[model samples]
Target: MLGATSHIAGRVLPAVGRVPGNVVEAVASRPGRVAAAGEVARRFGARVHDGYDALLGDPEVDAVYVALPNSEHVTWALRALEAGKHVLVEKPMALSEQDCLRIGRAAGDLVVMEAYMYRFHPQQRKVVQLLGRGEEGCGEAEGRGEGEGGGIGELRVVRAAFAYPTPVEGNIRFDPALGGGATWDVGCYAFDVPLWAFGVEPCRVWARFHGDPVDLGAVAVLDFGDGRSAVLDYSLEYGPRAHYELQGTRGSISVRNAWTTPHEDGVITVVTLDGVREEVVPAADAYELQVAAFADAVRGRRESLVVPLDHSVRVARVGEALIRANAVGDWVDLTSR
Candidate 1:
């Protein structure tokens, strides 16, 4: 792994233990304050490299997991792919479509995947199934309904938020030059899930931002074709909380603690035209599922579930336009990019 010190690496490295044909061979990068990276490597009987090059140079390391900052994803990912190592990069694959395309081009015949762990959770799969069925109460009711008014309603308003208090001064997330911003951070997930669920590219986008140095918060509207739309909000100033709400004409479905550290038990509540139904989804180790899926892709056993490179690139394009729109206080047309 390239960024052994990140919060994600800490969770995912151990999860890779459960999947077969995988081993934590090395931890790379400059040492971190937590020392957890060293501890993790020691626990796994893996060697710790003082630098990323050492890990990449190792003849036995077959693949790399990149949990670096947003700005570095493209560079490190491309380097890893050029080194002939498969890559599983953290989300917001790059800050722009051009960078994503460059990284994708570099991957040629190797695996290069963006890491969106929740997509692998069983609850997420169930939600997809429920949406596909579009029938009330036929499945676990997290939230399912048809609006009393009539037209067959697909997902209408999607509300997603991810926030956590950050006191760490000089963290990468606060550095604008490093692509640190609420949009690049949590908003990527907010935009990605709905885009994937709706299975359509957005036709229009409007956004607003708050805070300085780095945007402390943002709200955006994505217009998918067919009158379907998504609304997203994100911040770093709020108390720890993450949730997603998908509303349809018949009813609405929501997941509580949709995204959180130490990933909590996911809850789905469905409201239908007839009544309200709720289901408590059991806690799952999503990190393990993410790692297992990555390993499966590495083994050529299956395709990846995270948004593909092209899709992620398009998402980044939308994000870039959102940033521009937020600055000018005008809706930005993204058709060209």
Candidate 2:
């Protein structure tokens, strides 16, 4: 693991522990925080490195889980790839599409995945199945047809919101240079679900931001063309909430706890001409499932990655456009780019 971030130590590491054959192996951080890294490493009985480079050079380490700040993702991921280590970097892989592409190019034949653990949850897979598509790697091979919105009868629009109160005093989410903002932090999740549901890249987008140095909240719309779109709102200054509702021609699906799935289970409500039905998805550690997928990819046992780099590039492209849209206070054209 890298950076020893709270989310990594508190959530991701525990999930990794739950997965068979996977191990923490090692932990690293900046010199100033090496002691903290060691503290985290001790919990897993793993070795500690003084800095990222030291961990990257560790011969026994076969892969890395990068939980570093957004700005550092590309640099460290590139370094790790060059060291012949498979990488599982956090979401919003890079701040720019170019950087994401650069990583993709450099990662030739290497197992590199963005850590979007939420997608690994069975609830999301259920959503994908309902949409008449397969979750990232679970497709025809899993006997699920790859038709479009078969269950929902043509997905037309997606409404998503993810927000939570974040402290401004010392939180990285408030630091502009660190790639901080509500959009980069939470809106990315909103951006992803629609893209995943639609199974296509957006053609246009518009956004309006609300903070001075960094966006504490923002509202945006993504146009996928052909009468399909996504309306998204995210914030860093609100009561905790995360969910998305998929609207279709014949039916609609609403998922509560869409992003985190913090409880023992998640619920999905579907409404159609027939009637409204509720689905209860038993809780499972998405992070563990993600780790298992990564391990499979590393061993060359899986032909498809859970979160491919190209998807991250698309997310970065939309993110860049959103920031630009905020700067100019108008819709951003994604087609030309």
Candidate 3:
């Protein structure tokens, strides 16, 4: 693991320990943070390195799970790729879409993935099935639905929101230099649901930020055109909240506690003009499942990852465009308007 001091990394390391054939072989962090790194190393029974470069050079380490701050992601991921290691990076892959492109160019034929564990959850699988996708796998939107174009066809609008009470002092999320802000921190969750649900990218984007230099909240609009659009709204000042709703021509889906749903079995409700049906999803740890998939891919047991580099770049463009829009108070056209 690189940048092992993050709490999210904490969660993933333990999951890596629990998942079969996956292990936390080594950890790296800042030189001043040796105590924290040592604690994790002792708990995971893994070696520790003071510098990230040293960890990457370890021959025993085949793959690296990066849980670094938002700003360091791109640089470290590129470095890790150059060192000939598979990488599973935490979300927002890089501070800029261009950086994402750099990582992509550097990681040819190697497994490099952005870790958005939520997309790996069974709930998403349920959404796929309800939207008429085959139970085999994801994002394959064809066949329409039900009996010949019957299921939730013609996706109309998508709404996603993720907010928490507020940030405490010194939290990295509020650190501007670290590429911190409410939008990139939590609101990115909003984009994933809509983008991944319909498997489409917006043609134009607009957004507004709530504060200066640092954002306390953000509201963005992604215009997919053709009467299909998405609203992504989030705030650090709001009370605890998380939810997303997807509407279609025939039916709709509303997910409660959208992002943080427990790994255990969960329920998703599908509603239509006819009636509301509930589907049960078995217990699943998205992070753990993510680890297994990464391990499989590293072991050459799989072909592709769920959150590929292109998806990460798309997310980066949407977000950075939103930030730019917020700055200029103009609708930023992702397609060069």
TM-score, cand. 1 vs. native: 0.89
Across residues 67-158, which tens digit of lDDT does each residue of candidate 1 receive? 98888888888889888999999988998878888888888878887888777776676565557643321112222233332222556777
TM-score of each: 0.89, 0.94, 0.93
lDDT of 2 at 74: 92
Off by over 4 Å in 2: 134-150, 261-263
Q: Please give me the total number of clashing residue pairs in predicted model 2.
A: 0
Q: How accurate locally, in lDDT, is each candidate? A: 0.75, 0.82, 0.79
- Candidate 3 residues lying further than 4 Å off, grouped into runs, are 139-150, 261-264
lDDT of 1: 0.75
Clashing pairs in 3: 263-284, 264-283
Better of 1 and 3 by TM-score: 3
Q: What CA root-mean-square deviation does each model show from the true structure?
A: 4.4, 2.6, 2.2
Say which candidate scores most in TM-score.
2
Candidate 1 residues lying further than 4 Å off, grouped into runs, are 31-39, 133-152, 260-264
Model 3's TM-score against the true structure: 0.93
Q: Which structure is stronger by lDDT: 2 or 3? A: 2
Can you write out model 3's per-residue Cα lDDT over 222-318, one digit (the tens) per residue? 8887787898889888957678888887787777765554445666777877788877777778788778877877777654366767778878877
